[model samples]
Target chain A: MMPTEDIYQPLLNVIEFLGTFAFAISGIRHAAAKRFDWFGGFVCGVAVAIGGGTLRDIMLGVTPFWMTSSIYLICTFMAQMFVIVFARSLKSLDNTWFFFDTLGLALFTVAGLQKTLDCGHAFWVAIIMGTITGSAGGVIRDVLLNNVPVIFQKEIYAMASIIGGLAYWALVELGCDMTISVITAFLLIVAIRILAVKYHISLPVLRGEE
Target chain B: MMPTEDIYQPLLNVIEFLGTFAFAISGIRHAAAKRFDWFGGFVCGVAVAIGGGTLRDIMLGVTPFWMTSSIYLICTFMAQMFVIVFARSLKSLDNTWFFFDTLGLALFTVAGLQKTLDCGHAFWVAIIMGTITGSAGGVIRDVLLNNVPVIFQKEIYAMASIIGGLAYWALVELGCDMTISVITAFLLIVAIRILAVKYHISLPVLRGEE
Candidate 1:
């Protein structure tokens, strides 16, 4: 599949770096919180940073973005070092987790949606890919940590990504500028996630028993 | 991109059915043991039945096998029903778990290795794919149940698949009959797995601390 045009190349690159770093840090911090060792922490960091995109690339029939560049691996390594260095000071900052996770979710959602469209998938498929891109890494991280996936626990996590993808698709359909559409979608996801958490909102459980 | 020749179609079909059923039952039993609800158990069944092959197909740049056939879904459904019907009698039969898991692992490894070779990948890549196909489903199953993946718990699980794959590759290189190569790989994996468990053999753990 083709990448975005040259005009948006630099913007996309920044998103890639920031999103990957945020995700990597989130996983590393989680590893630290759980008292996993250095190598385990690094593995978690890399998994959170690259898992979603790797799945997306495989589905989209492209080489995974991480495999093509050393930058993402370096970002994860830096995240590992950051966690080790800041362990004492960062002991009680749940907000740090929220911020990085939310930011990564928003940015990755946009990137996945745009990449799917670039690969000529329909809007609905792109939206699904965006949600997967946004949440699958966290699922993997939780799995590795032996926790039931938080997203599957009725949180507004993947839903926020889905909502953002829908808004982006609608804006593009309505002839908005590409940058405007991307910004709006990103902000909307962050706002929705924040509001959902602050207000104790969640999807209702689908009970198996009557 | 392309499937195997029609000459091999029926043989592959039987393997797919048996492998899917065995994996589905293995995961369903795990969920039942964990006291998860029916829906949760069903989810695990489907996840284990299809997850490995889905990943393999995605990596091979093919539409996942389950996407093309309804038979796999039916197999999972039947597995779920089998669990419900035999819940009490099956409660203490760990051998049932070993049988299905080992059989599924062996069958899937061979199927994945053959498919990768058909897709024109090198032998080493095929070996990796075989290991993934054999072990990744169990990883997903354990993850869903919030358990450390059994394969990573120093068990000779994925390694058995890799060894089987190497044997298959060597046999093919030695110009053994195709059926002979396939049967040898599948049986070797099963035998290795059984022997490992019987003798308490395991890979050494890599300790995080000195």
Candidate 2:
């Protein structure tokens, strides 16, 4: 039997925590690759972990979720330590990284949708917010790392998030409750992401001036 | 000739408009230097003109200022056209750019301070918000341009904004009216910025990985 708050409020918190940790680890890795110092790495980690949700909350006229709790900050610091301790081994665990990144994306998308709806936003705005929650952190990370955002370079992950958001809406409209809709949407995003990676599927690249 | 709305709301709007135009032009000019296309240049222009205000409003729990009016967006477009038509000559006018940039920095600092106070935040928070409004757009622009932010490299302009905010507070506490305090603070920022540039003053560079 599902736990009380059976609407998955408890489940959402767990997903949010895991997503924060994964994104923080990913950010620290990028900062390390750029040869930033320890302090720089920690800054990057924190930015990636909280940037998306902070932006979403600001736009939603709500206080940033992280500001209400120190757990996200502590999680990022732990991620920084984990990178410092296992910098090389972390790279060798590409499959593990892949799984965590995929999981993070799925969790963030669902959580964003749920929060936006709870805040009384329309389904369209929720979809946009969901995509932003899933991918905007990476955009901020890319900015700090001095690269064009990956979403701009190619649309795979952002597109996946958008589709996941749409899937959630569709399921809801089809009479699935919040829990069923969330689970199905999360799985759909993971499947799309995995399939795209495995089959090398991507949108067309833009050609420059001839 | 003191005006009604004795709080200087009209003056704030004028400063805001001029600041937006200057920042937008600066953004477009940089984008052009990077060989960004017209669309890319416009995007950068909008980011620079409204970026800082957007961030500040978000942090302050208000809807972004730009969403309430299309004037800022239109102004950025005009700035883009201004750049396209005067691309080469614009470089020859460094003194003009300095004037506009300084004016923009000072104006944004005061506006941010005023808005923060209007939102009922503490003076210290207003000071921090002023600094952000004065300088964060350039950080965003630098990120888009793939360079480390100038603020990270040295703290001259941000320091000026901070000093300006403090000056406003001091003047108000000394019994000056709102208009007098605002004008004095704006001039103080401009003076500090000019002096810093003229004297080549900057914080010591951080030496790394020796």
Candidate 3:
């Protein structure tokens, strides 16, 4: 299943680009923390921003959206620029960046779910795809930077995506318009993520025998 | 291009299964070293064994080979069994495992190249895909384990795949049969990797300004 021509495509593209920029910035921050060179940081950022969508697109049997569009690449470059120019004051800007990152995750989750639904997959598969689109990039970034993936840790990250996906599913089942359902899902994810962080809510750590 | 129906497919399947087994075992060994539980280890092993091929298949806009085949999952299970049953003597079996891992890389590189060529891609693209098939799993494993990727700082790993791909390309250009070219290229990768490890030949560490 592929995206049919849509009059709303241009607006959707804007949302996608915003998400890409924030995700890339998050990736760049991690790479910089690990002292990767400029080129390495840029590559890492691109990987983080586009990795999930690329995987989803491949699974969908379409050419990767990033490969077809220069905008995503340019967004990554801009992410690198943000890191470079704000290097000295980044710690102070953490909250601001975190806001954008959360918004990006929300937007991406909506996009992922809508795309999967458009492909005519079942709800459960759509949930998984939406979660992957929202969180896989961060997992890849953590891995590349030699850190335990945050998703597997105490952060309520992927859970937010799952819950948000269910919310979208429920809305669609009730005959909600596609745009309204998407926005509802997006807001749900953003609100969940923000509240989780603000309240320091976390899943219990798994205990394995030493 | 997709796999044409071939009489020799059984033999190819055998090679692919062998490679998957070895790759899975390599991933399991890493997981064990990190003290991950059996379930964690099994998951890790499966990720390493099929991660590269999955990526390649998706990029080529085909169903991931593992999705249609049970053999790959079975092979990962066998790898876990080998690890569990041989736990006491596994450390001493490192060299034996290394041999299989090298063989896996060689076989996978050949498979990747053939698939890319079948898809009507140019030789350079085939080479890149071949290297990805051989190396991406290890990169993923290293990242998941919070270790620096060996590909970024190791013995002639991806280089061997590149050189082997070049050999295959040259042989085909000179009118060699596809089977012979694949075999020669596979052997070349195996030999180079083994020799590189035996000689401790590593790429120089890149020094970035601290």
lDDT of 1 at B169: 89
**What would the per-residue lDDT of candidate 3 be over residues A29-102, giving only the tens digit for each residue?**
88998999999899889888988887777676767777876988999999899889988887887887788788
Off by over 4 Å in 3: A1-54, A61-131, A140-146, A153-210, B1-7, B35-47, B54-89, B199-210
Q: Cα deviation of B27 in candidate 1 (Å)?
A: 7.2
Compare candidates 1 and 3 on lDDT and give the better one: 1
Task: Please write out the lDDT profile of model 2 over residues A61-93, one tens digit for every residue.
Answer: 887777556788889988877888777678677
Candidate 2, Cα interface RMSD: 6.3
TM-score of each: 0.60, 0.59, 0.60
lDDT of 1 by residue, A105-137 (tens): 898888888898888777876886788788888
lDDT of 1: 0.81
lDDT for model 2, on a 0 to 1 scale?
0.81
In angstroms, give how far residue A134 of model 2 lies from its true place. Answer: 0.5
True contacts kept of 2: 0.18
Off by over 4 Å in 2: A1-11, A37-40, A206-210, B1-54, B62-135, B144-146, B150-210
Task: Provide per-model DockQ scores.
Answer: 0.13, 0.13, 0.15
Error of 2 at A86 (Å): 3.5
